[model samples]
Target: MTVLNEPATLLNGSAWTSHVFLGEWTPGSGGDYAVVEPATGKELARLGSATPGDVGRATARAVDAQRAWAAAGYQERAAVLRRAGALWEEHAAEIEEWIVREAGSVPPKAALEVRTAAQECYEAAALASHPVGEVLRSEQPRLSYSQRVPAGVVGVIAPFNFPLILAIRSVAPALALGNAVVLKPDPRTAVCGGVAIARIFEAAGLPAGLLSVLPGGADAGEALITDPAVRIIAFTGSTRAGRAVARLAGEHLKRVHLELGGNSALIVMADVDVARAASAGAFGSFTHQGQICMATGRHLVDRRIADDYVAALAERANRLPVGDPSGGQVALGPIIDVRQRDNVHRLVTASVDAGARLAAGGTYEDLFYRPTVLADVPLEAPAYAEEVFGPVAPVVAFDTADEAVALAADSEYGLSLGILSGDGLKALELAGRIPSGAVHINDQTVSDEAVIPFGGTGLSGNGSRMGGIAHNLEAYTETRWVTAQSELPEYPY
Candidate 1:
């Protein structure tokens, strides 16, 4: 293993000779691509993009490694993961810095990502020794039981936003369940998501070839998905890409888990604290430049207090500091790239053209877009109708509870929703009416905990849960029933 004295230097414009891992860092036969820092458009490194052949070789290695990994038993697996989790905490500073530099994550958001990743590792470790089988009673058989077995190799394709944590959320669970994984992280945050994770696991004494990190674009993901050795695909990205993965994996009859895009809504009821709800809306809509899948895309406020809520939200949005992530003073950092920035601006401009009044911000300085608030946005506007994954919040007024529920349920994506109301029972009632995978009461839409079933419905996902124990049991395992007869009865013909 190549150990650097100052591992933080890896984040600075260092050239990587390999991207595919098979027991070690193996050079890719494909072309190299530059890893551009989204915050500054500077070249952090040039990483080799894996070709189809490279992915196949990695999959074969994983297939071989999975057998011994499964037989290693849960106790051994738990030890390795616990060590990996400790390593993650030890290198928290560097990992946080990498997230900010590569993915343009703000300081606090980056730190949270690191913290969450480490916590996921720890959480996954606990699953290693947990009971994975159940006793069964049969009518005729002497003994009957069902056992949960690993799904062999799992393919993990993670997105740039919250890359490390998202990847860890999938990878750790698969590993803990005794499945070898080949991860293809988003090319944008390859170092933080790929290299950093590989090193940590390798140092923690995980068997070589058990886990591989390949940093590439769509080609690598397609290669992993199509490989026969891969039994399951755990994907977190846009709905378009998730659909493609689902379709392809279906052809092979392989299991797939997707956590896709969401246009979550934050509904402020008439009896709630308008200022607090506005603050929650602002944070939900603009945190991490609003790149989160569960970030609030629409603010549906009661018409009676709509104006007051809009004013409070606008004040908070305008007061937020926006600049380079390295400055350590900014709450909002740059968008992922020029295209993303342009796409966000286009949506905002189109909403304004459709008669939405911009109340706070509608401007950009370089890649850093100011937190924007638009009030009285029509339902048909792109900001309200689609996933405008930028630091923009479009507020729409609703007259009644039914109208609020209708507005929230009008989206094709049903990942998450936030309801703010003084009455807990009312919020609970409304949460039940919304058809989303997760509903937050008295809180913002953008919330994730490792212990919860994290996934989505409809276009948001394929209904395969990630995080939590249920996801671990479902995504990484297959059930097998075993029956034994103490005495064989005479064959009746």
Candidate 2:
């Protein structure tokens, strides 16, 4: 195995850090993680673990840098991001490799993420021009207007599922709103984030102190929240982790934006095509190997048609090529690693052991698990009850619309939902009744267009992202009522 002594340099103008200063595990500590090539079980790189101290230093730099960056004014700030976007586009190819190598993301997905990163920077730069608040109406009582200002420094703790996308979602918004960012990305996928930042910041001419990236494990995340300097925290991960981040940030009275876990329920009524529902089911559950938080895992089908639906879905799923991600024929890649593969395996085994009939795939082994589909799996089964974030799709038949609604709303997570029904009007009615963040009548969950506020209800997330709700301004700034026309208080009473 080859160890890159100078993995890469972090740039803040001409100065650079040679070795990774972000608290990597030392040789003797025995805390080493590998980034493997998914196509072949070959080890690509070995990374040192990140310590808590590294988190503190990174947080301090981001917090301290915010003052100067916020003071740089709109024009200077915009110029930096603009340059960063240009550089990112120029070096997009190298960044794509980092993504595929570290996160094991397929080429199509990785390339799209790289392009999206550039677009995010470009979009954020544009947002810098709009004043946060303006005069809505002017009347006699008093001059009333809301002005948005910086929320100090923001702490972003992201996940590995879609490293580039999640990082950009948090970083771009915070920066556009004039908040200095201290980002703690997934330890397993730090290289992707680091290189992306380097390209954008290098091109944009952003002052060094404005952005700080510290990549490590959970301890680094905890440090970012506990610090007094970080006034806001934006996290995307498991429900357990989200809660901890929220609790810590609350202690400091900081603003928090969280996108936690989810287990989506895709409903299909008798009105829609069984083939269509089956098609949607395979794409939703198997895409990304079911790692996405918003992926559909539960299928609440109309009782009269459940059997046919499951059969067609099985056929569709089995037909899709599942193997090495590099092959053009394969639509789905292997499970991230043995860790998640095992997790899915355990859940399915318990469900079967508990008396739930296994309908399709029961095959599970090293590195990858075959596409899993479970039927006659009761609503109470662990696979059904909890988030089955794997290539598992369990279909449960429901008699009436009320039953379907109840089944769909069974989980506390309200991330994203979809319904397949011929009647568009009925679909809309059902969507309103079911409590999810976003709903689609004829399309699948990944059918997310760039324009909507993509988030969930209850435990899914505290708020939304994307889709012009790009009020990232809210996350990064504190609103202050500006009184241009000064007047003394009428009475102290």
Candidate 3:
């Protein structure tokens, strides 16, 4: 029923729109909203919003579905999740297009997001039938064990950047573990994160009412976080938003997992190849227009080679093509919205005013900001101290290895760090000194895999992993201990 070459065949009418509940595309009962494509500054879609009442309804349904879904056993869940993975691959192109249109991601970035989403589904499927309980030793004639059981309902609130993969990273595991989900995708990229994922899972035979996608702004997210029936809250966003989510979830005493913002650093030692290090630094700082949380905002290099590395990096940044994402040839796309674009510009301006030299670029046309590189950056500059979340890299020169380690560790956000050194031992030594969630040797800061414990420390996260099997321990399930006694024993009753 589908042709391989014709992508238009997949984009029928409203097939990619995702405001759903109880396995149906029900209309929203709250306010109406519209999203503009940053690439062209044109209205992409007009969608409905969700109210607190809608949250109540979705919460009740999630509670009901979670009970039945958990009772279906792992085999049934695995089959459904595997089918969802296959469906995701089958519709990869359409999903890629949605990501580009909705999130202002370049072709390569959009493709990676879709690919990662599919992989997450398959990986989660493999975990479906795996062992979840462990046997415990007992002294008396009794058997004791502990098993992981599903948390009742999970509320997933995803950010606009990397909307598909970040959302799927949490959604896949939650579904595989038999927990119902109430997903609140960012209003900016609801088409990809909300509509596309919901359709795939529904087509893959997921039970009705098991997953709900409500695309709205802060009000909807607040409703989802505060809902009484939602037992767990998994959020990925800015540090400010994550703190708010944590506070609200705390009020309800709900289990909360957050993957917040990051101001990652990429350190180049004196022994490494300056050209190669600069290339990696360019990619690390400008990928997805540097919207990624793990993107390197600070470039700390040995002063011996700082000038050469900065020149090479600036050349790479200036040479990168920037334009509309739909053209499919640009390396850098537009920012998510006017607000974000202005925020990035303000930081760039302030950093330059505060004694940082604009080595490459600090300009923009509409929402498209050029890949910017700053040299001689002071420690107090916003470009050095905060998470810019834009295509900006501030280079800071360091004298000794101790200074480099301390510079990298000085950030308030400790999500990820990169070390490029010819000496492996030296790189490992530096990595050991940095306090971040992930440290990569001889690589860029922007790296993620489906099977690793991806998250952060400090303000970057709230002591919870977002990916790998380790995340499921805190996010999707709870542990319960059980004991069987062959003979009665006296107790302090």
Candidate 4:
């Protein structure tokens, strides 16, 4: 293990020492690619990129390593995860710096990501000691039981937004359950998403070849999904990309766990204080520049108070400062890149052109997009209909609770939802009528816990959950039924 004190040193070390870890520090056969800071648009570091051939090689090495890893004792595996958790906290400052720069996260958001990632490691450590099997009654005088086994090599594909948390949530659990991992992080966020994880496991003394971090493009991602040695795939990204991954994986008869896109909604009841409700809505739609999969894309307010709610929300959005997070205090950071910024601006522009009122924002200086609010937005408006993935909130009025339910359920996504009301019972009943995977009463939509089962429905994801002991067990392992008898039973031939 090597000691690295600075982000630059760590990245340079990773580039020179190994492009992709395959049991040892090894250079990539593919060429180098530059990493640019989203906030400043400056080249941060140049890392060696992995090609499809590199993914194939990594999967082959992972298949060989997984056998030995699965044979290890549960305590040994648990120890590695626990140590990794401790390392995350011990190196929090350096890691947070990497996240803030590489992912364009505000200081608080970056810190939260570090904490959540550490919690994920600790939770996964506990999974190693959890019940792995069940005993069943036998009718033919034989011992019968079903036990969980590793799913061999797992392929993890993580997106750019919330990179560290998304990648580690799958990586830590898969390793704790005795499965080797081949990770493909988006090339733009490769260091924080991939290298930081590899370094943590390396320092925790994870066995060689058990984990491989290969940052690459779609070619590498496709190779990972199609690899025969990789038994399971855990993907967190756009709905389109997830569908492509699922299609390819299905063709190969491999299991895929997807956590895709969302156009989540936050409902504001007429009974609540407009100011308080607007505060919650702003937090949901503006956090991390609304780059989260669970970010509130729509705000459904009772028509009687819709005007007041929109005004309050616009006030909050106008006050929030958007700039380079590394420079000073700011409420929002830049979009990941120019392309994403253009997309966000395009949606806002198109919605306004189609008669949606721009209540607040709807503008940008370079990549720093202001927190935007669109009121009286039509149902068919692009910002209202699609997942903007930006700090833009589209507000639509609903006359009754039934209308709110209809408005919320209209989207193809059913990831997360929120309802704010004075009466908790009414909110609970309303939540029940919605089809989202997770719902919050009197709160915002963006929420996650390491111990909770996290996933979505419809186009948001497949029916697979990605957290907690039971869900992680299901995601990373396979169940096998076995029976034993002292004497051979009478056979019918």
Among these predictions, the greatest TM-score belongs to 4
Candidate 1 per-residue lDDT, tens place, 401-491, comes to 9999999998999999999998988889988988999988999999888788898998999887887886788879999998888897888
143: Cα error in model 4, Å: 0.4
User: Which 10 residues in a row give candidate 3 its minimum summed lDDT?
Assistant: 1-10
TM-score of 3: 0.96
lDDT of each: 0.87, 0.72, 0.86, 0.91
Sorted on TM-score, best first, the list reads 4, 1, 3, 2
Alpha carbon lDDT at 176, candidate 3:
94
Model 4, 7-91: lDDT tens digits are 4334445444436666565677677788889999888877768889998889888888889889999998999898889888887
Q: Is candidate 1 or candidate 3 better by lDDT?
A: 1
Better of 1 and 4 by lDDT: 4
TM-score (all chains, Cα) for each model: 0.96, 0.89, 0.96, 0.97
Summarize candidate 2's per-residue lDDT along 1-493 as a digit string, tens digits.
1112222433221232222332121231225466566556777565445566766665666777778777767877777666667666776777777676567667777788878777777777787777678775666556778888888888888788788888886787678777887777786676676535643564455555567666666766777788888888888889878888788888878778888888888988987888878988888888777888888878888989998988887787667666666645566667767777788888999988876777677675465566777887777788888887788888889999988988887788888888888888887888888788878878776654333466778888876554343466766788888655567657678
Model 4 CA deviation exceeding 4 Å by range: 1-18
Residue 229 deviation, candidate 3, in Å? 0.9
Score candidate 3 by lDDT: 0.86
The CA root-mean-square deviation of candidate 2, after full C-alpha superposition on the true structure, stands at: 4.8
Instruction: Looking at model 4, report the run of 10 residues with the lowest lDDT sum.
Output: 1-10
